[model samples]
Target: MRNIFIFIIFISMLFVSLSACQKEDEKLKGLVIESSSVEFGSLQNPEDRELHFRVQINDYGMESEQEYKVRFIIQDAHISDLIATEKIEVPETYKTQLLRNDEARTIVTGGSKEIKKDFTIDEIRKIIEKDEAVIIELYDKNRTIDREVVTTFAENIKPLVKVNPNAKLEHIKLKETNEIDIFSRAISDSNKEQGISYIAYPEYTFSLAEESYFLWVTENNGRIMNTKDTYTIYSLSDSSLKEVKEVIDKK
Candidate 1:
């Protein structure tokens, strides 16, 4: 009789342990992300820009509500922008853990996620282009257990233009002689069939001596239309081409 009682007690304990283990296993089941992309327009200057994203864990079974921490990381230096780090909580009901005696205490399984952002053409023209890596992370409360995620964003590689060695032209036309048009497409190629190709306009005021004009033109885009050092002089008194040498001589 004593032996039988001991055997019965052991069987009951085993059943209880197995039940607890099953409950905990059930809590680690589901995962989700609320939103994948967040946009940051025109950060700092017109050049700096960024994007944000979030990942959420969900549908975990729990006796009471609990919370989990989340984080972000940038893995590839060339692809992503590391703007800032963020943390969020996952509710207990959305997370699960097994009983003390259960072999499966907590089970969380998911794949790496991704988020992306890009620069506009105008923004690319204003800044130097380079590749960068971005990463995101999701962490537990103590920050001990963290899941790192990574993705890449391509940098803009368009050419830009700036004015250098400013020269004064006499009687410039506001409509036809606009500096914006002149500098922007100053490095464009003139083709009879296509007219002009891959030309970008400048975006600054023409100044004297101290100011330098700079422009970016690439063969891939097109060739510069005009290579003359002097400006065309247009006047009602004499509508003729005068060498810039003549103007500089007068100065």
Candidate 2:
């Protein structure tokens, strides 16, 4: 009788362990990182000498009960072993939200999300080389969701500089049209009011001459709020930007 009882307990424990393993497998299998990379472009620094780069987050993941946090580590990959790196944090949403009154089904085949984080290229120059490999790894706790490696060519690096945010916005019409426009056009916009968040105040900025400008990025009820540079400001004035350009391309 004692032997039979011990065997029964052992069988039950084995079943429980198997079930737990299966659940964890399902959670990991469903989350996919389609691609991870860095984007190079004109940055939003005042001196106009800085280059811009951002980590591109293109991923597919299963819906969860609530918002989850994911991290990206930027590392050097040109050597035999991974070298210098930096960390960036991002918050993501899963499909676990309750459906609306008009909704019918709760099951979704898959969900896709795109995210980006901007950084100045000058900071990481020590680890950069000609055609050097830049590796970006994505993780949730100790589990690695995905990894991407990119080679740099013709990328520039320099000492970081202080962009003049204190440049005053003078409220005066231009006598002669030239470069410095305190308030320029908003290259993009948040279609909905909810997604709008301003990172750079309009009055504190001087126009950067790059073809592509920057803006504060946030989301509203599933809508993304970001703006680019459209045109140049003709004059230097301290006037309220809203009165001049309407949208000052907040970065």
Candidate 3:
């Protein structure tokens, strides 16, 4: 009789442990961030940041009654230490099953309700060290992982020349030196018909040292915003110009 009682007690504890784990399995499976096309080559301010990016999370284990938050983290990839944490409150609507192309999916994908909470260049630079990591995840008070994804953002920011659509040409500046070598593309006869001559700055008034070729652009040439460019820039270091970056006005 005594042995039977002990066996039953052990069996009861095992059942409770298994039940706890099964309940824990009710959380999401994984999270992913939509890719950003933010090319801040010479990005100057946080105002130019891509503030409204989306994050997709698996809702397989969301709690219907409780609220959750997505946390953006930047850390050292190798050291695995937190450098910064930015949290965005998840909407109450996402606390349920995710639906998709006429079928039930398990993902909660959307943007932040508060635009200011979006990550920006200032926040990204905090973790710009070599081999750093950026992580985004969802978590309720008691729920955790599959809730998260680890990744990084843009790096290697360099100064590049730009040609505006309205025929305004601008030079990207280095922290120390504003001078760069400029080269002109051979304008074919076909392109000349489009009034491909470089136009002066329409808004700002500035003095040019002389006929600076690298600083000119074919105004109103229908150039792609980010894919087409008219100048090859070279760094003006120590009285000599060395080709550094080829600037493109990509669409």
Candidate 4:
């Protein structure tokens, strides 16, 4: 008789565990995001630019009363600064089952939502520079599941260049040499319709003897052309411009 009572208790505990497992599966799962085009826009319309995308909520494993708050963001790829954002609320999915003459059919409602946002080229430029990437993401309020795409804003934007603070110019005194703004130079070339391909990347600018020059590192080698002397500077890695500065100091 005691054995029978113990068996009954064990069966009850197993049934309770199974019920708990089933209840845990009632959370919503699938949320997807899709976009028509990754490119923000072209340089043709410099004044106006727009971003378009879509968000989809799948009803396959969605819960009956589950609600989701979705957020869309356009952020800088290098720095996660928010450029633009939009929020949306998705209600619980409604489903209906119909049976007629031994035939059963299920109809699902509430799935996809279209999101369209208008932005300016200036807004994108403020976030990301030329040749740099921008990130567009769609995520739920929980931030657990997200979809993102990385794309460049425009090809015509000037590359971001700044003085290398870590660079040491021991050979030249500070008053004797001036810092050259390579970004402005690239913009000037672009304005002339000559394109900025010449000074796009891996380039260093320095002023020596009141003459500004650019040293371009190509094919693992950098060339600096001057009327006085031409220096062949080899770069071990393109990660830093300090090597270029070191060579200049040595010369």
- Name the best candidate (by TM-score): 3
Q: Global lDDT for candidate 1? A: 0.33
TM-score of each: 0.30, 0.27, 0.33, 0.29
Candidate 2 RMSD to the real structure: 17.5
Better of 2 and 3 by TM-score: 3
Q: Stretches of candidate 3 above 4 Å error?
A: 1-48, 51-53, 61-67, 76-93, 98-132, 142-145, 152-214, 217-251
Clash pairs, candidate 4, are: none
Candidate 2, 5-62: lDDT as tens digits: 9999999999999999899866544444433334332333222322223343423233
Model 2 lDDT-worst window of ten? 217-226
Better of 3 and 4 by TM-score: 3
Task: Please list the residue runs of candidate 1 whose C-alpha ends up more than 4 Å from where it truly belongs after superposition.
Answer: 1-49, 59-68, 80-136, 145-251
The candidate that wins on lDDT is 4
Tens digit of lDDT per residue, candidate 4, span 159-227? Answer: 222224466433322232222332223222321222222333324554554454444545454433221
lDDT of 3 by residue, 115-200 (tens): 23323344444444233344455666656533333333343233233335466544443232232222222211112223233333
- Score residue 104 of candidate 2 by CA lDDT: 23
The Cα local distance difference test for each model comes to 0.33, 0.36, 0.36, 0.37
Model 4, position 238, has a per-residue lDDT of 36
